[model samples]
Structure formats: C-alpha cells, structure tokens
Target chain A: MKNFIFQNPTKLVFGKGQIEKLSELIPLDVNLLITYGGGSVTKNGVYDQVKKALKGRSYTEFWGIEPNPRVETLRRAIALGKVKEINYILAVGGGSVLDGTKLIAAGIVSDKDAWEIVLSGVAENQIPFASVMTVPATGSEMNGGAVITREETHEKFSFGGDYPQFSILDPEVTYSLSDHQIACGLADAYTHVLEQYMTTTGQSRIMDRWAEGLLLSIIEIAPKIKESPNDYELMADYMLSATLALNDFIRMGISQDWATHQIGHELTALHGITHGHSLAIVMPGTLRELKVQKHDKLLQYGERIFNITEGTEEVRVNKAIEKTEEFYRSLGLTTRLSEENVGEDTIETIARRFNDRGVAYGENRNVTGDVAREILRKCI
Target chain B: MKNFIFQNPTKLVFGKGQIEKLSELIPLDVNLLITYGGGSVTKNGVYDQVKKALKGRSYTEFWGIEPNPRVETLRRAIALGKVKEINYILAVGGGSVLDGTKLIAAGIVSDKDAWEIVLSGVAENQIPFASVMTVPATGSEMNGGAVITREETHEKFSFGGDYPQFSILDPEVTYSLSDHQIACGLADAYTHVLEQYMTTTGQSRIMDRWAEGLLLSIIEIAPKIKESPNDYELMADYMLSATLALNDFIRMGISQDWATHQIGHELTALHGITHGHSLAIVMPGTLRELKVQKHDKLLQYGERIFNITEGTEEVRVNKAIEKTEEFYRSLGLTTRLSEENVGEDTIETIARRFNDRGVAYGENRNVTGDVAREILRKCI
Candidate 1:
C-alpha cells in the first residue's frame, strides 16, 4: 500500500426524482451557470425536470457542449461565465457537459485559456460546480478528472481538479438513452475499473475485489439493461457503478494502468469515435499486448470476473481477453478497429502522436509509441 | 435502490508517518483539545509523535478515555473544553477515545448535558474535530456515528452528526496493538459489513459487492496478520477495511440490518465485553434467527465469501453461518455466549430493555425485543 491522501466531497443525490432536490442543494446566493450538451436532455425530459427544480431561480444557460467535451466550446462557456460573474456551475447533461464545465469552472477563476488549463494537467483554481448527470459514463459527476478535446490539433487530454459539490443522479433519465449510448456507458464503466485494476496483484486486496465487483455488476446488468432499458433498478445500478468505477474509491493505495484509456482517447481524437466505444476497441488489444506485464492480476481477474479457472495459464489469459471483448460485444459495441473502419494509417498516426509527445503509459510506464502501435495492430 | 443523499467530507491522510501532518491539517488559530486513552499511546510512541507534530501548538490534553468510551469520562473532557473555550478537538487515539471526543465536541457547544445529547440520537451542533487514529476498530475516525456507554446505568447508546473534518490513519501506529485488540478489530469490521449487507438482496449491487469485498479482504488477511502482525501492507489493508466498513460508503440506497450491532451493544453494556468481540458472539446468532428474512443475501454471501456452492440451499445457508462463526474463532474471539459465560439472564435483560424502549432493527424493522431474545437464545 502507498502513502495517500483521499478526499471526495461530492454529495451524491441518487435515485428517482433526485433532480428536484437540486434547487435546495445549491446555495441560494451564488450566480449560477447551468451547462448542457447538444439537446438530449431536452428530449429526455431532464431539461424540464431541471427547470422545474430550479423554478424562479435566475441562472444563465449554456448549451452545445459536445461529446468528449472539446475545449473550443468550453472557452466560450468560460467567457460567458466571466461576463455573468458565475460563481457556481451546474452541468446538466452527460459526462461531456460536466467535463467541459470543469474547465469552465477553472477558467472562470483564472486568466488562463480553458485549453491551457486542460494542457497544464492540473487545475487548482476552480469555481465550484455541481451536476445533474443524465449519463453514467466517465464518472465526471463524482471524480475530479476531465478529458477535454482540442479541436485545432485534434488532441484529447485530461486534467485533474475539484469534484462536483453535488451530483443529482436520477436513474430514470437513463430510460431515454439510445442502445448505443447505453452500450458505450457500460463499456466506459467496465474499462474504467479495468484501468484502475489489471495491475500488479496484492497491492490492495480490497481494491481488487471492489474493481471485480464493479465489473461483475456491469456484466450482469448489461444484458438485462438491453432487455429492459426502463428498468429503474437496473439503470440505478448502472448509474451508480459508473460513478464508483473511477471515483478514486477503488484505486486506494494501489497501482493503476490507464494505458488503454490513453490509447482509446487517441482513437476518439483522431477518428471522432465515441469515447467509450474506442475503449471497447483498444482495451482487449492492450490486455493482449501487455498480458505478461499484467499476468498475475489478469489471472486473478479472469478467475474472479469471468470464472475462467479451468484452463492452462496462457489459455486462461487468452480466454480472459476474449471474454472482455465479448462482454463489450454483449453491450452492442464494436470491439475491433476494423469494424469501426479504423486502419493502419490511423494506428500509425496515434503512434506518431505518442512518440511526438514522448508519452509512456501503463503501470511500469513501458507502453511507448512502438508498444502502442503493436497494441493497435493486434486490435486491427 | 432507495432514494438517498450521501456525502462524507472527512479527509483521510493514510499510510506511514501521517501523524506528522497534523500541524498542517489542523488550524492553529482555534482553541484545541487533545484527547487520549490511557498510557498505551505513550508506550507505542504515538504520543511523542503527536506531541512532536504539535510542538508549538498550544492545546489542552485530556486523557483516560477508556474502551467503550463512557460518557462519565467524556463529561469531564467536555467540562475542561468549556473552561478552555476549545473550539477544535484533535482526538489522538483509537475509536473509543475518538467516539468519546465526538460527544465532547457536541457538548462543548451546546448547553445540554452530554448524556442528553447522546439520548437525543443526533448532535446538530458540534465544534469541529479530527483524529490521529491509533486503532482501526469502530470506524469513528471517518464517520458521523459514535457509540458512547453510560457507565452509571450500565447502558450504551449511539448518536449521529458531524464527521471528523479529517483523519490521519498511520498504519504503523497499529503495530503496538495487542493481539486480542487486533482480533476484536477484525471482528468489528466484519460485522460492520454484514450489518450493511446480510439484509435485503439487490437493493444496491455495488453496495453489496463493496460489503462482500471488505468481508473477503478481512477473512483473507486475518491469518496472515496473525503471522506477521506488523506487516505494513497487511495492517494497512486491515486499517483501511475497518474505516471503509462503516463510513456510509457501503449501504448507499440500501436497507441495513444492525440488529447484530444493537444486540452486541447490549452484551458490551452488560458484561463489559469488548465491542468487537460482542459482535463476533452475536452475529452468527442474528443470522440464525433471521435466516428466513435474509435468505437470498446470505446465500450470495455464502457463494462469494466462503464458496459454499457444493451444498443445497439450506446446507449452504447453515454452512455460511457456521463459516462466519469459524472466521470469528479464527480471529481468536469467542463466538458463542457460552464461551463468554453470558447466558439467558443477560439475554432477558437486553430483551426487557428493548421492549421497554419499543425498539426494533433490521432491514424489515421486525427484529423487536422478542426476536432479539430468540436471537440471543441462539447465541446461548
């Protein structure tokens, strides 16, 4: 176990109709800037619910925060926030809106550009933000991480900062989600757990079990959620699992391998692939490429999560990787680069980007540009 | 899942040498009250460490807070705090000392008697308090709940409100704990999870998985810890499991069965059994009495934690109960009322007390006094 400081102050207002409590949760005096993504909240009735909750409360609204949360749009939100003197941001859509709002929160308090804040890799001066989370992927509702895409250079990067002061997670909102969105959300959550897990074993047993637990829940709920998308209980479980997956709860005193996510983000940046779908495509490849590095933990994960205990070591590892991609497929996601029309050129471009950035990822920091190319080739 | 709003604001500074961080963690401007148990900390070097950390900080030291944390001793601490006009408290011992300090934190601000505050079941007003936790049992370091015994009446009760602002969990401090203390701590943590879990099945899958994760970790670590009592990683797992067990992190949007704890507290108040040991003795009994109500969860727990998949439903449930008692015995705690020399007379007293108070517990709220008697008889 490693020396660490852990504190997450996000007040999770969960379950049915929790958005109604939003008016009471936020303080009465702050100048509010409610941010949203492209119009899904409107179709889903989340916009109406949020408005009903904040009835008579004066606030500025910013829409058109895109998926993957580009800084190009967030800079505009920040500029508007500064003009409105917005002291509090209320993000009212999916992870993208909340992730973009995180930058706006930081940008409102500093003279730095929103993209500069994202590139700086840490934003220490953030105005407080809360969320009415309509999507369950990315865990932006509870965690301090935000992955922002740069439109100019076609790059995506993450910065860490303040968590939401509160997040209203009404699982009922998930009933209106597309099957593809639900699939991506489940994949995002599963990969989130795997990113934190799939490392060296025995660092923290509780963390391992917790990561396994989230994976099992995601796996179990995926098929059922497909059959009954409006199932309140199933959606609630999915929503909560996503928030718990990357909220620093399961990574306590443990090593994490975000190599798959780093590769996946590149896929999203270069191709405009959905963030979670890119992870589904890349994770199996990373696992196969880095199998020896993550051998023991993979074996344990195979046994615990997929019940793959009756095989030789290599057979079990291969089966575990197969089962992982199968689970993503089970969620209706395309788990291969070719299925998404991504090919050698894009893979080489991602490798070039990594090499240019001099980036090395994974638990041991050995996943260099060449290693990434091999992983991507395996996916192809 | 149930409608729920959850937030815990306690900052945990964990791992080796975190006590030295107290000076920076606590504000120097506030009047401070440093609380302690008897002289064990003095021998363990935790005292010198805390003293060294707060070398220049002017504070009042209140010592002799015994196990089970009697209100009798805490009243004196409260009076002293009032005299010194202490607005901040830094409890530098185990759960009992910190639990007692929770009351003192409440008492120093309110005009009401400390006992009255405990009886009120909620302390709305409390001066800020934090802890340098020396023991891992009871989880008072990171939670709002505090159990305080009223020694004069041989009665024990709990109150809720105001989590510690921060807690320093230096696992190195646990090395000095007695083997018996470690046994009891492990038992306490195990039962804490079962209380949150072992209730209705499927209320929250993540919560159940987290509870099961803690239980599995405790069961696996108990033997290894007996062999290497001071192993940093093992003890860190133990210390962390204890805090996570009762920190409201599990039980989110779920019903809980604290009937074991409710019954266990009676054993503590009556016979002066250590808090955790009492739970070890009573929990299996609670399971047997309530097995019909907790059937599904018990089976799931059996399969997950103990791997009782080879048996019939009844056989698995019984095996699960037997294995739970066995785990407690593995921790070197007495698991039967007969082993502890408490019998029907004490059971009757607890039943009478519960009946007189018109109290019931468990997820279904049906573990009334008579049911408690039946549960206690099972223990006998």
Candidate 2:
C-alpha cells in the first residue's frame, strides 16, 4: 500500500428533520451568506424549513447558482459576499450551489479571481462554510473538492479546499427530486466508487472491500428507489452512499483511476450533459478501452459486484463492462454517445483539448489524447 | 435509521516513515508531554525514531503506562503535566498509553481527580493530544472513547472525550509485536465491527455493507497475517482495519450492541485478561445468548462473512455463533470462560456488579444482570 494522509472533519447531521439544525450548526456571530440554486427548494419545502430553522437570524441570500456551477455565476456570489462582509457561508441547495459557494468562499478572502482559483487547482484560503445539502450527487457536502465550469471557455475543472464545517443531510428532502435527478445521482455515486476501485488490485484489502461495498449498496438501492423514492430508509442509504463515495473514505493508500470523470467533465462542459449522466455514458467506454490494464481488478469487481464468475478472463472483463453500462441503463440513463447526440466532432474537440494540455490521466497515467479519442470512439 | 450527528477530526498519517512527520504535525510553541508504555518502543526502534524526529525540541517524558491503562499510573502523569504546565501531549505507545494520556489530558485541565473523570463517563474538557500509535487494537488513536482500568478496585470503565489532533500509524511498527498480541488485535478488531453491526438489520444498508466489508477484510487477513507477520501489506491491512473498525465511521445512524464489550471489560478487570482476549472469550457467548434478538442480522452476517447458508433460521444462527467462536479460536485466543480458568464465582460477581449498578446493555437495553449471567454461562 502507498503512503497516505487522510482527514475529513465535516460534521454530518443526518436523518429526518436535520435541516432544523442549521441554526445551531453555523456559528451565531459570523456574517452569514446562504447560497441556493434555481428555486427547487421552494417547491420542496426545504426553503421554508431552512428559513424557519434560522428564524429571526439575519443573513444575505445568493440564489441562481446553476447546475455545473459556472465560474461566471460564482463571481457574482463572491462580489455579493464581499459587499456583505460574509465571514461564513451556508449553501442551501444541490451540489452545484455548494460547489459554487466553495469558490465564493475562497474568492471572498483572496485577491485571486474566481476562475483563477479554479485554474490554480487549490484554494489557499477560504472563509468558513457549511451546507444544508439538499442533493446527494456530487458529495459536495463532505468533500473539499469542487468542480466549477467556465461557460465561455467550455472548461470544467475541480479545485480542492476546506471541508464544510457541517452539513445537514435530511434525506426526506430528496422525496421531491425528479426521477432523472435520482438516476443521475446513483450513476455519479457508482462511478465515484469505480474511479477509486477499478485500479491495481492488492493495494489494500479493506479499501477494496469498502469500495465494493458502496457499489453493492448503490446497485441494490437503485431499483428499489425507483419504486419508492420517498422511503426514508432507501433515500438515506442513497444520500449517505453518495457522500461516502467520494469523500476520501475508500481511496486510502490506493491507486485511483479517475479517467472516466475527466472525460465525463468534458462531455458536461461541451454538450451540457448532467455530470452524473455523462459519467454513465463515458465510464463503460473507459473500462472497455483500458480493460487490459484493469484486467485483474475487473475480474475481481465482476465476481463481487456483478456476480460474473463463470466466464473466461477475457469474457468476464467484457461481461463486467457490459454489466456496468447495463446498470446505468437500468437507472434510465443512456450509456452511449450517439444516444445523447454527441458525435465525433465533440469527441475530437475533447481529444484535442487533452492534447493541447499535454496531459495523461488514469491510474498509470497512460490515458493520453489518442487513448481518450479511442475510448470515446468506442462509446460512439 | 436514527437521527445522528457525527464528526471525527483526527488526521491519520499512515504508512512507513510517518513518525518523521511529528515535527510538522505538532506545533512548535507548546509545553509538550510525551507519554510511553513499558519501554517496548525502546526495544523496537520506535523510541529512536521518535527521538530523532523531535530532536532539539525539549519536552517531558512520562513512562510506564501498562496494559489496560490504570488511573493510578495516569494520576502521576497528570500531576507531572500540571507541574510542567503542559498544554499538548504526544502519546508514543500503544492504545493503553494513549488512553492513559487522554485521562491525564483531562485531569490536567480540570480540578476533579482522574478517577472521578472516568466515572463521570465524559470529559467535558481536555488539553489537545495526539499519538504515534504503536498498536493496531483498541482504536484509541482515532476515536474519542477510552477504556481505563482502576487497578486497586479491579474496575474498568470507559469515557468519551476529544479525539486526537492527529495520529501517526506506521504499520511497520507491527513487525515488533508478538504473535499473541497480533492474534488479540485481530480478534479485537473483528469484535468491534460485530458490536456495531450485529444488531438490527436494515437500519442502514450502507452501514451494514461497510461493517461487513471490515469484517470480511479482517477475516481474510487474520490467517495470512499469522503466517506472514512481517509482510508490510498484510500488516497494513490489519492496522487500518483496526482503526476503521471503531472510529465512528461504521456506526452512523444505527443501534449498536456493546454488551460483549461490557461483559468483556468485567473479565479484564476481574481475571486480568488482555482486553482483546477477553472480548474473544465473551463475544461468542453474547451472540449465543442474544441470537433471538439479533436473528436477522446474524443470518445476514452468517451468509455474508462465513457463507453459512442452507439451514433453518435457528440452525443458521447457531452456526454463525459457532463460526464466530471458531474465528476467535483460530486467532489463537480462547473463546470460553472455562478455558481461561474463570468459573461460576466470577460470573456471579459480574452479575452482581451489573445488578447493583442497575445497568442494562445491548441494542434493546435488555441485557440486564440476569441476561449477563446467562451470557456468561454460555461462555462457560
């Protein structure tokens, strides 16, 4: 196992009516800024709950943080935070809003531009921030990483920063989510585990089992959630699984392959696909393209997660990749580029972008521009 | 699932050569007190490493915190800390030394005596403390709970307090551990997971899977570790599993049955058994006695961990309990009170103590003194 240092200090306030904890979670003296996305919280009663919880508390509000949280949008929140002298932020929406708030928190305290912070790949300093996490897809509630898009440049990049001081995850709020949102969330979480797990085997047995455990849980709940999305227990599993998936819990002392996420980010940046849906489309392709490199781990994953133990090694790897795409399809996501109307032009652009940056991705750092193009071509 | 608020802020610095990070991990400007056990570290070269890492830094050293960590020994450390005005503590031994330091940290800051703080069941305030953990069991390095024994009274009790600021866990330290110590550590970790997991089923699927994940990892590594005790990867798995097993990572929003631990502590206090060995002897008995309450979970554990399927419910439950005892025995620890030479008098003493204390344990709060007696009888 490789050497690693791990620490996550996010206080997770989870379960029913945890939203009421907002008043106490955030400190009383700080000048607060509550950030939100486009008005879903209003329809879902989350807004009312949050307001009632912090009754008589004075705070500035910043709304309109969009999906795939753009740096263009977050600059405005940072400006508003600067004017309000907001020392702390409470993000009250989905991953995008929280991701945007992360940038705002950094931008508020620094002279660097919001986009410049994203480009820097690490936020040196940030105002304190917490969240009333209404969505579970990106795991922004607990992790320090945030992906921000530059709309004009069609670029999406992630930056690491301070974790939330606290996150209130009331899974009951998810009862109002659309089926498509739920599907995308499940896909995102599954792909998150795969990113950490589908690497070289024998690094750490506990990590492998944990990554597989989350995969098994996500696979089991994806179907049941479709039938009973309002079931408190099912949604709780989904919410917790998403948070634990990418919160640095399962990647301890292990090699990780995030090539699929890098490709998926391009899909989201160029074609405006949902982050998780893009992963559902691209992850299978990456697996197929890099099957030989990931062969042993794939065989183990196939046997444990997909129960594909009866086949030959080559056949089992293929079956595992097929089963992965099928799992996404089972969640009502289209797992092909053509199905989403994303063609060769977009794929070539992503390849050229990778080439321009002179970068290689994945566990072994071999997924260069040509490899990316090949992977995308397979998806097509 | 239950409503819960969870947070752990201990930064885990793991892998080889991590002890050198002490200079950077601990602050420069503090009166630091370094605590130690009965000089195992001195023979193991850990003492030399720690001394080299903190060279040119002046600090007080308190030695001779024995196994199970007594309040008597800790009071001397506390008095020394108070005299030196120590604000920071770096415990450089196993769990017992760290556990003792936790109390000393609390006692130095409060007017109450160390034993009073232990009986209070919670330490309201404690000076900051970190650890260079040399043992793989107890998980005191990463958790907020500590078990301290009162040698004079033959009493053992636990208290909740602040987590370590950081913990350096280099699995290479395990190379110096005796075979019996390794066996006890493995059994301790395995039982820790069961205490959290072998309760109600369906409280949280992710929690169950994660718990099972740890269990499976421990089981798979136990025998391999016995053969290859010096293997870095196997020992790393063992070390990491022990930390993760009790670090509040698995018990989120779930009921836990610590009845085995409660009963095991009595065995330790009365007969002077090692903490982990006592658990090995008591855990299977707890399972056998409470199998009816833990029916579904036992069956699930049976199927998942031991693959004990194809039987009636009672048969499966019995097989699971038997397999649990067998696992402990395979670790080279005795799983019966009689094997340890304890008999009816000790059982009655434990029962009388529990009855006098008016304490009922386990998930349902029904493991009263009578139930404790029955469980002890099963062990016999």
Candidate 3:
C-alpha cells in the first residue's frame, strides 16, 4: 500500500428527473455557459428539461463540441466564454461535451492556450463547472481528468482540472442512445476498472474485491442491458458502475495500469475509433501481451469475474484474455485491429509518438513505445 | 434505485507514515484543539509523532474521551474549546475521541445546550475539524455521522454534522491495538456493510456487489489478520474497509437497515459492552428474527459471502445467520447476550426505551420496540 491523498467533492445528484436540480446546484448570480455536443440533448429532451429548470436565469449556450472534443472547437468555446464573461460552466450533453467544457472552463480564466493546457497535462485554475451528464461513459462528470484532441495533429491527451461542482445523472436520458454508443460506454467502463485493478496483486484485498465487483457487474449487466435497454434497474446499475469505476473509489493504495487506455487513445486519435470501442480492441491485446507480467492478478480476475477456475495457470490466464475479448465482442464490438480496418501504419505511428514523447506507462512503467507496438501487432 | 444527492469532502491521507503530513495538512493560522482518548496514543507513540509535527503550531490538547464517547466528557471539551476560541479541531485517537470531538465542534459554535443539540439529532453548523485516526472502527474519519453517548442517562444516539476536513490513516498505527479491539473493529466494519445492505433486493446490483465485496474482504482477511495483525497490507485493507463501509459510497440509491445497530446501541449504553462487539452479538439475531422479510437478500448474502448454496431458501437463510454468528465468535467475541452477562431485564429496558421514543428502524420501519425485544431475546 502506498501513501496517498484522496478527495473528490463532486456532488452527485442521481436518478429520475434529477436535471431539475441544475437551478439549485448552480449559483444564480454567476454568468453561466451551458455547453453541449452536436445538439443531442435537443433531441433527447435533456435540453428542454435543463432550460425549464433554469427558466428566467441568465445563461448562454455553447454547442457543437465534437465526439473527441477537439482543441480547435474548445478554443472557440473558450473565446465565446471569455467574451461573455462566463463564470460557471454547465455541460449538458455527454462525456465529450463535459470533457471539452473542462478545458474551456480553464482556458476562460487563464492566459494559457487551450492546447498548452493539454500539453502541460493539468489545469490549476478553472471556472466552476457542473454537468447534466447524459452519458455513462468516460466518468468525466465526477473525475478531474479530461481528454482533449487536436484534429490537425491527430493527437489526444488528458489534462487534470477541478471536478464538477455537481453532476445530475438521470439514467432515463440514456434510453435514446444508439446501440454502438451503449456498447462503447459499457466497454469504456469495464476497461476503466481493469486499468485500475490489473496491477500489482496483494496491495489491498478490499480494493481487489471492489475492483472485481465492478468488473463482474459490468460483465453481468452488459448482456441484460442489450436485451432491455430501458429497464430502470439495469441502467441504474450501469450508471452507478460507470461513475464508481473512475471516481477514485476503487484505486485506494494500489498500483494501476492504464497502458490499455494509453494505447487506445492513439487508435482514437489516428483512426477516429470511438474511445470505448478502441479499448474493447486494445485491452485484450494488452492483456495477452502482458499476461506473464500480470499472471497472478489475471488468474484471480479470471476466477472471480469469469468463473475460470478449472484450468492450469497459463490456461487460466489465456482464458481470461480470451474471455475479455469475447465479452467485448458480445457487446457487438470487434476485438481485433484488422476487423476494424486498422493496420500496421497506425500502430507504427503510435509507437513513434510514444518514442518521441520518451515515455513509459503502466504500473511498472515498462509499456514503452516498442511494447505498445507489440500489443497492437497482437491485436492485428 | 432511489433519487439521491451524495457528497463527502473529507480528504483521506492514507498509508504508511501519513501522520507526518499533519504539519502540512492543518493550517497554521487556525486556533486548533487536539482531542484524544485515555492516553493510548501516548503509550503507542502517536501522541509524540503528532506533537513533533505540531511543534511550532499553536494548539491545545484535550484528553480522556472514553469508549462510546459520552456527552458529559464532550461538554467539558466544548467548554474548553469555547474558552480557547478554537476554530479547528484535530482528533488524534480512536473513533470514540473523534466522535466526541464532532459534538464538541458543533457545540462550541452553537448557542443550543449540548444535550439539546444531541436531542435535536442533527447539527447543521460546525467548526471545521479533521482527524489523525488511530482506530480502524466506527468510520468517523470519512463520514459526517457520529454516535455519542450520555453517561448520566445511559443513552446513546447518533447525529449528523460536518465531515472531517481531512483524516490521516496510517495502518501502522493500528499495530498496537489489542486482540479484542481488533476483533471489535472487524465486527464493526462487517456489520456496517450489512446495515447498508441486507435490505431491499435488486434495487441496485452494483451496490449489492460492492457491499458483498466488502463482506468477502473482511471474511477473508479477518483470520489472516488474527495471525498477522501487524502485516501492513492486511491492516490497510481493514482500515480501508471500515472507512468505505459507512462513507455513503455503497448506500447510494439503496435502502439500508440499521435495526441491528439500533438494538446494539442499547446494549452498549446499558451493559457497557463495546459497540462493535454488541453489534456482532445482535446482528445474527436480527437476521434470524427478520429472515422472512430479508429472505431474498439473506439468500444472496449467504451464497456470495459464505457460499451456502446447497440448501433450500429457508435453510440457506438460517445457515447464513448461523455463519454470521460463527464468524463473530471466531473473532473472539461473544455473539449472545447471555455470554456477555446480560439478561431479560436489559432487553426489556431497551424495548421500553424504544417504546418511549416511539421510534422504528430498519429498511421497512418494522423493527419497533417489540421487534427489538424479540431480536434481543434471540441474542440471549
């Protein structure tokens, strides 16, 4: 167990019709900017509910933040926010909007360019922001990290900032989501827990159990959610699981491996794959390539999450990796690179990027550029 | 799932040698009052570490807050705090001391009488406070709820107040705890999870899995801890389990049953038994008496925690209850009132107390005075 400090102050207002809390959750006197992505909230009734709640309250709206939350798009939002003297940000769509808004919030109050903030990898000052979270992926609603992309350069990077002042998560808003979005969301959430859990075994027993619990939950609810997407109980579990996965709740005093996510981001950046589906493809590859290094935890994860106890050590590890890929495929996603039309060029590009950055990731800091290339080739 | 607003802002500084952070964690400008229990910290070297960290800081120490944390002792601390014009509190001992300091924090700032505040059952305003937690029980470190007793009247009650500003939990500090204290702490953490769980079935599967994860972790670690109490990893898990059990993380949008805790409080108040040990005695009894109402959850608990899947529903439920009692006994705590030298007179007294208050507890509010009496008799 490592010495660490943990604090998250995002007030989660969850359940049906919780968007109405927006009026009370935000201060009325603050000049507010409600941010959105491609106007999905307008179709889903979330915008109407938010408008109804903020009736007569003075606020501006910033729309058309893209799926990957591009830096160029957020620069315009920041300029609009600066011109409007916006003091608070309310992100009204999915993770992309919230992720963009986080950058916009920081850029509004700082002289630093939005891209500079992303390059620095952290934002120290930000206008207070809250969310009417319409998606259960990325966990941007409760966490302090945001991934922003540069369309021109084909790069994506995450920056840390203040958490939302509050997040209203009404699960019913997810009823209209496309099947691919739902599949990507589930994969993202499951991979989030795995990123934090599949590292250094025996650090903390309770943390291991908790991480396994979230993984098991995502696995159990994934199929049931496909059968009945609007089932209140099923979506409720999914919403809760997504938030819990990245909310600093399960990673206490433990080593974590985000190598899969680091690789997945490159896939999203270079080839425009959806964030969660990229993880669905890359996580199995990372596991298969690193199975020996993560042997014990993979065995425990296999037994606890997949009931794969009747196998030799190597067999169990292989089965765990196979079951992981199968789980993602079960969610209507392809876990192989070639199936997605991605090839060696993108892999080499990502490897060159890691090499240029002179960086290593994962718990042991051994997932270097060459290692990432190996994992991607395994995926191919 | 229910509509809920969740926020806890306590900064948890966890792991090895975290107490050294106190010098930087607490602000030097505040008038700080350091509170403690009956000098166990002095013997354990925690007091010296705290004093060394706070050498140049202006602070005063208040000692002798006993087990269960009586209002009588708290009033003295409150009076002293008022005299010192203390605006910050740092509780340096176990949960008892921290619990008493919670009242002191509320009382020093309020015009209401100390007992009146307790009778009101909630403190809306409190001076900022933090803790250097030396015990792995009660979870007062990360939550806003505190259980305080009135020795004069033999009454115990809980009140809601400000969460700690920060808490430092160094697992090494728990190495000196007695076998009995360790047993009681483990029991307290386990029952805390059950109180939040063991209620309505299928409301939230993620929450259920999280609760079960804590239960399984405790069950798996309890015996290992008995053998190696000073093992850093085991104690880290134990400490984290206690904090997470009651930290509002697992109870989101879920029904909770604290009937066992309600009855157990009376046992602590009347018989002077340790609070957690009392719960260990009474919880199995509560399960036995309310098995019909909690049948589904009991079966799930049995299957998940104890693996009691080879029986009929009724048989499985009974076995779960029996296994719960057996686990407590294995922790070297008595699971029956008679074994602890209490009898029918005490049970009737508790029943009368509940009846006088006209209070009902549990998820369904059915654990009335008579039900409590029945539960206590079962414990006997």
Kindly list the per-residue Cα lDDT of model 2 for residues A1-380, writing each as its tens digit. Answer: 99999999999999898888788788899999999999999999999999999999999999899999989899998988888999999999999999999999999998989999999999999999999988889998999999999999999999999999999999999999999999999999999999999999999988999999999999999999999999999999999999999999999999998999999999999999999999999999999999999999999999999999896899999999999999999999999999999999998999999999999999999999899999999999
Worst 10 contiguous positions by lDDT, candidate 1 chain B: B199-208
Q: How do the residues B1-380 of candidate 3 rate in per-residue lDDT, one tens digit apiece?
A: 99999999999999888888899999878999999999999999899999988887778889999999988888899999999999999999889999999999999999888888888889979999999999999999999988989888999999998899999999999999999999999999999999999998988888888899999989988999999999988899899999999899899998899999989999899889999999999999899889899999999999999999996888999999999999999999989888988998998999999988898999999988999999888988
TM-score of each: 0.99, 0.99, 0.99
lDDT of model number 2: 0.94
Tens-digit lDDT track for model 2 on B223-300?
A: 999899999999999999999999999999999989999999999999999999999999998988888898999999
The C-alpha lDDT values of all candidates are 0.92, 0.94, 0.92
- What's the distance in Å from true for residue B125, model 2? 0.3
Off by over 4 Å in 2: none
Worst 10 residues of 2 chain B by lDDT: B285-294
Chain A vs. native, model 2, TM-score = 0.99
lDDT accuracy of residue A15 in candidate 2: 89
What TM value does chain B of candidate 2 have? 0.99
Error of 3 at A261 (Å): 1.1
Which residue runs of candidate 1 sit more than 4 Å off their true CA positions?
A: none
Residue A230 error for model 3, in Å?
A: 1.1
Instruction: Rank by lDDT, highest first.
Output: 2, 1, 3
Looking at model 3, the pairs that clash are none
Write the residue-wise lDDT of candidate 3 on A139-256 in tens digits. Answer: 9899999999999999999999899999999999999999999999999999999999998788888788888888988999999999999998889889888898999988887888
